[model samples]
Target: MPINSYDYYPLSWYPDSTRIKRPKYEAIITLLEEDIVSGVLKANTKLPSQRELADYLDINFTTVTRAYKLGVEKGLLYTNIGSGTFVSSNAFKSITISTDNSPAASIDLGLVSSFEQCNALLVPAIQKVAGQQTITQFLNYQAPTGTAFQKEIAIRWLSTLGVQTIPERLSIVSGVQNGLAIVLSALFSYGDRIVVDFYTYSNFIELAKLFHLTLIPISADLEGMSAIELEKICQLQEVKGIFLMPSCNNPTGSILSASRKKELISIIKAYQLIVIEDDIHAFLTAPFLADYSPPIYQSLPEQTVYLYGMTKFICSGLRVAYLVFPERFKNTLNRSMFNINVKTSSLDSEIITEVLHSGLAQQLLETKKALSQEANALFNTIFDCQEVTGHHPWPYFRCLPIPKHYSREYIETYFNQLGVNVYHSDRFVVKSDYEKAFIRVALSSSSSLEVLETGLLKIKEGLVGLE
Candidate 1:
C-alpha cells in the first residue's frame, strides 16, 4: 500500500534502512526517542520538515506528521511555527505519556544500575554519617583526589578485588565514568587510537566521540576480546590504550579468561600501550571471579589505571569511585582531575569511606550478589535467553536471540505494548557494519520480583512471536 509522495527538503535523519514490521509512525517515534536520549539529536536541534522526513523514509506524509505530534505529546519534540520542529530542550527528562489509552505503565529494562538490595544498609550508613560529631569535615573543600582517609578506604576496597594499590597512587572521582574521562584527558591526546571490543559499553563509545579519540574495535567472542586480533591491530595502527571490563562485562557478560588476560597484557607491553581497566562489576561477580581471571592491573600494574567503582554495589546516590593510576602518571592525572572537577565531593567521599571501614559494605555486596542470582534464576525460568547466571553480579542484561522474521525494532515495539521497555543490540555496537538479530533484556530495573515476573512472562511471549 503506497501513499502519495510529497516533495520536500532532504532530511538527514533516517532510521535503519532495512525493512521493518512496526508501523511507520511507531518506528519514527522510537527513532526520535532513541536519538534524543542518546544525545545524537542535540537539545533544541531542529528536525527536518515532516514531509521531508516522510519522503526520506518513503513513508506517508500523514504518518510522519502523526509521529511528530506524538513526539511532542511525549515531551520528546516541540514545534515552532516559524522555525519548524525541534528536539525538546528537556528531551532528556523522564517522558510521561497519557496513561488512559496506552498500556498501564512501562517497566524500564534498559538501565543497568541497581542498588535496591543494599538500601537496608545504605540508609543507615547515610544516617550514621549525618549524626557524626565531625560531620562538618564533610562540608569543607577537599583535594580532588580525595582526603587521605578516603584514599585509604579506596585502597582497601581495591585489595579485595585482587588489585593491590596504595593511597599514594589512588585518585578519587565522582564515578567510573568520570575516572575514564580523567584518564583519557590526562594521558592521551585527541585522535590517539584506543582499542575496545566491537560490541562494548555504550557509554565508552559516547566518551570516545566526546573526547575526539579514535576507537579501534577488536573482534570479540564468548570469552571476550580476541587477543590474536588485537595483536594484528596493534601492528597495523599506533594504538595508545586498551579499555576492557574483564569481570562480568556489560551486555554480553563475557569474562576474559586468565590465559587470555596474560596474552593480551603481553601484547600491551610489546606495543607499550596503556590499559584502562574498568572493574566496577568486579564485586558483583565475586563468587565466580576468583575462578576465571585475575584483574589485568595485576599483570600490567605499571600500565593499567584500574577503575574501582563503589556506586553499583553499594549505593548509586553516593557517586564515589577510586582510580588506581600508574605511579609514573600520578602528577599528570592529579593535575588534570583537579582542573576538571576542582575537588571531589566531600560528603560522598566521607560517606563511602565510612561505609567501607564499617562491615556494612561487605554485607551489602553479599546480599546484592544473592539477590542478583535469584533474579537471574527467575529470568531463566521464563525465557531461553543467554546464560548470564552464576557468581557474576550485574544480572541486569540478558542477550536474547531474535526470532526468525523479527527485527529488533519490531520485537522491542511488541514488548513496549505490553508495558515493558528494552534496548536492542544496535545501541551498543562500536563498528558501523556490526549487525545482530538480538535484544538486551535488563533484569535489574524492575521494581520488585512480582513486576519482574510479569515483565519476563510478557517478554517470553514476545520472543516466541506469540500474540
Candidate 2:
C-alpha cells in the first residue's frame, strides 16, 4: 500500500487502475500523455513516487520506473532528484526549430551564433596551418587529447579568461558538443540525476536523454541560476552534477552573477557535484561585462570540467574545443575520449592553435563584437519591447514575450509565413513550467544588418498582425 494514501487520494496524480490496458508500463505512459495533453495533469504537477504509484496501481515498481523513463524521453514528464516525478513544463506542446534553409526569403533568427563573419579574419590562420611543412603531423590520428604545443596555446587562452590550469589537466576535443559527450560518458552513469537551468540548452537535453541521465532544472533569474532554488533541489534529491553556461545563457542572455556564483560553489561543494562549465560565450561577453567574475571552474577546479569552444567566438568551421578537467578526472576522461572519439581531428585543433598563437583570435573577437553591437542596435530601434539588456549588449540572441493565448504551432507558423525563424521558449524549457511564453530571436544568423532588420520588422509585423 502507498505510505499515506487514502481511499479518496493525496497523491498528485491518480490513474484509473481498472482502465489500464495490456503491458502495464505502456499503459502508464499512455495515461500520462493523455492526461497531460488533455489538461487533466497541469504542467509541473508533481506525480507520485514510482514505488507509491506502483503500489496504488497494484503493479510492479519497475513497470512504473520504465513508464516514467519513457515519459521523460517523450518530454511528457520530468523528475526531481529526491522529489517525485512531475509533468513536463512543456507537457502541453513540444516545439522544434527547422534547420532547413530551403526558403530563399527565410531570415534565420533560429540558428543561434556561428558568426561566420569572422571567417574573413581566419583565412590567415588557416593558410598558415595548411601551408606549414609539418602540417602532415596534424593529419594523423595521434594526440587525440592534444599535442603539448596545442595544450600550451589552450593554457594561454584560458588565462585570458581567468582560468589557470596545467597542460596535463587539459584535453583538446572537437567542440563543446563532443566535449560534453566525453564528460557525460566519463564521469556520469546511466540514470544519474543532473541539475540544469530552467531554460537550458536544448541540445544538452537531448544529449542527457541519450546517456539515460535525468536532468533536474533549477530556477534562474536575470542574474542566472538561482542558488536558493538549487539548494532546495539539492536538499530534496541527490544530483550528480550541473551543466552551466557561466558567461551568458542561450535564448535568455542571463549572465551568472558573481554573488550567485559564490553561493552555487558552496552548495556544489556541500553536495559534491561535478560542474560542466561551458564558457562558449565568455570571449564575447567577458570583455563587455564590467563586473564580470571568474568562471565557476576557477573556484571549484577539482569539481569542474571546463569547456571552451572556438565555435561562436572565433572559428566556427574549425570545430575545435579546449577542455580542462581536474587531476582526478584525467585518466578516466582520457580513456573515454579514446574509446568514443579515437581522435578529435588534430588538424582542426592545429588551425585553432594557429589562430590563437597568431593573435587573429583577438581580432576576430573585436570584429564580431562590432557586428553583434550593430545587429543589436538595429534590433533595438525596430522592436521597442525587447527586454533583455546588459553591458554585453545582446551577444547573439534575445528573448521576447509572446501572447499567452497563441499556440506553438500557431506562433511558429505565424513567423514561418512571414519568412523568419524564431525558437519558442518551450523548445528550451527543462522540467518546470515557464511563468510566461516567449520567443528567442537570434541576431547573428541574418547575413547583413538590413536582413536582420527586415527579420525584426517581420517579427514586429507578425506580432501586430496576430494581435
Tens digits of per-residue lDDT, candidate 1, 106-154, equal 7766666573645667777789889999888777774657888888877
- Which candidate's TM-score is highest? 2
Model 2 vs. true fold: TM: 0.83
Q: What is the lDDT of residue 366 in candidate 1?
A: 78
> Measured by TM-score, how close is model 1 to the native structure?
0.75
**Worst 10-residue lDDT window, candidate 1:** 93-102
CA lDDT, candidate 1, residue 203: 74
Q: Write the per-residue lDDT of candidate 2 for residues 1-467, one digit (tens) a residue.
A: 44555577777888989877777877787677678768889978888888888889888889889889767745677777888788876666434344764255678888786666667777877788899999899888888889999999889989989899999999999888889999999999865778988887878877776676777877777677889999998898778899999887866778888888998999999999999999999997666667889998889999999998988887657788889999999999999999989998988888888888887877887888889888887877887645454324657888778886776667777798899988777778654345678888989887778888888988998888866
Weakest 10 consecutive residues of candidate 2 by summed lDDT: 93-102
Question: Which residue runs does candidate 2 get wrong by more than 4 Å?
Answer: 1-74, 78-104, 385-391
TM-score of each: 0.75, 0.83
